[model samples]
Target: MTAPRLKVFSGNSNRPLAEEICQHIGMPLGEATVTSFPDGESFVKINENVRGHDVYIIQPTCTPTNQSLMELLIMIDAAKRASAHRITAVMPFYGYARQDRKDQPRVPITAKLVANLLVAAGANRILTMDLHSQQIQGFFDIPVDHLFASPVFFKYLEQFKGDNMVVVSPDVGGMKMAAAYAGILGAQLGMVWKKRTNATTVETVNVVGDVAGKDVLLVDDITETAGTLANAAKIMRDSGALSVRAAVSHALLSPIAYERLALGHIDELITTNSVPVDTRGLPIKVLSIASLMADAIVRINNNESVTSLFKIKGF
Candidate 1:
């Protein structure tokens, strides 16, 4: 039996990753024209025949987030109008994910808003990776295939696993992720309790677990200013940690992040190409998720189970 025609399209954000995904899936990039009008409005036109085909629009809402998000929405709407059998918004990096809830008064839940917008724009499903919060999955009323970058991290961290290793969380919110890593790697779990003094300043209150003479792995979903990671690394080192390395899914490191990284507080920063992070000779190691996303797209098109993408053995 012939496989149903599967088409993949991309937006201005993270085009290289989309191209890599197409290459991994052994498919040609779909024909689409995305441009902006003289008034800075996004305009999208599907150039190829997509009627009755399963279409996947890969757009990571990274930097220039609002613009990229608009492009994704428009693309999904175009696919739906063109009579695609199904449309999945393959977002490697979901923007506005940090605002998943209303912790403060009069604030908006932008994550939920994004979910509604995607569905309203005719996305039948969503394929994303390492959302800032797991509950962000529940924001969508539609079927959401939330893939993790853990497998990608495990594949790389497997080599560095041994005695005297501990996974550390830079904040209380990340204890769950750190615990998962600790359980998978058979290493100890540690947490750095932090208090935000200001927008960009963080104070490490205390270390919860032992790190004397042990290599530490700090796990986080994203790093913007990197103040938290750098402060945690300093605290870990002061507490006798042999080394402090960070494994984060999204590396949206800013200028200060690079400056802090150069301070030698963090030994290594491992991240994925979920965003265009420039290592630029810093001790940052970037892994690719193109294969992982490619496989997920293939399985979704074939109607196969994607549960095993979350399992890990020996980290």
Candidate 2:
């Protein structure tokens, strides 16, 4: 039997990234009308035929989180009702990921709720990159193909490879990610111990491992207010490090984050274009993951293994 025809569509959240993915895939984005009603309810209509076709919808739930997420769920429902053979929701940046668990009383596990919502809306599979926690995949009953942005970061970080480099995790929770980058770059590993003073504030209590006289590369899965990174960078500099930089997979830069970044604690902020980012004249470098995601989509469509994509040397 022949495979289902593949068709890709986009919601309003990240049309540019979706267009770039289609460009890399050598196909035009499937026609879809995604808009809102006067009362702000989302409306979606797949303009092209997708009956028995393999469909992929690209929409990252970034800022305006609820709206973007609703759009994705609606789009998935539309595809399901249209009789698509298989529908994969491609979320480059999964929002509500930080709320994976209920750390506080009377709080809900919003991440798990989001997963249940997606499955309920009829997503057959999920393709996302670098979730805040690896275990978010368990929230879904459907097959989840989680991709990493490390390959893209590794290629760009080749110039920084040297003996005097140290990969530092901004906090203890990210030590594993920092260790992976350290191994891949052949650098030393370090970590920061922090205490959360409030929802938007962080205090760095101590630093582990040697970073003096070394070029520090702080690695973390996400950053929003820049508090954690900025605080960590300040300590690294004060500790006599040559220079401090950060490699954050997702840069959810808010106005406060921009203000903090402008303070110049970190020399550079390297991030992926998983969401819309405005550098605002800061030393921020945004790398494209369009090609990487496009390659994964192709492999998935071909029923081939995507495990090889994670095989970075020493990682």
- The best candidate by lDDT is 2
Query: lDDT tens digits, residues 1-315, model 2?
Result: 667899999988789999999999999999999999999999999999999999999999998899999999999999999999999999999999989998889999999999999999999999999999999999998999999999999988989889999999988899999999999999999999999999899999999989999999999999999999999999999898999999999999988999999999999999999998899889999999999899999999999999988877533
Q: What C-alpha lDDT, on a 0 to 100 scale, does residue 51 get in candidate 1?
A: 95
Q: Please give the RMSD to the true structure for each candidate, in Å.
A: 1.3, 1.2
Worst-scoring 10-residue span by lDDT in model 2: 306-315
Candidate 1 structure quality by residue, lDDT tens digits, 126-209: 999999999999988889899999999998999877778999999999999999989888899989889999878898899999
lDDT of each: 0.93, 0.94
TM-scores, all candidates, are: 0.97, 0.98
How well does candidate 1 match the true structure in TM-score terms? 0.97
Clashes of each: 0, 0
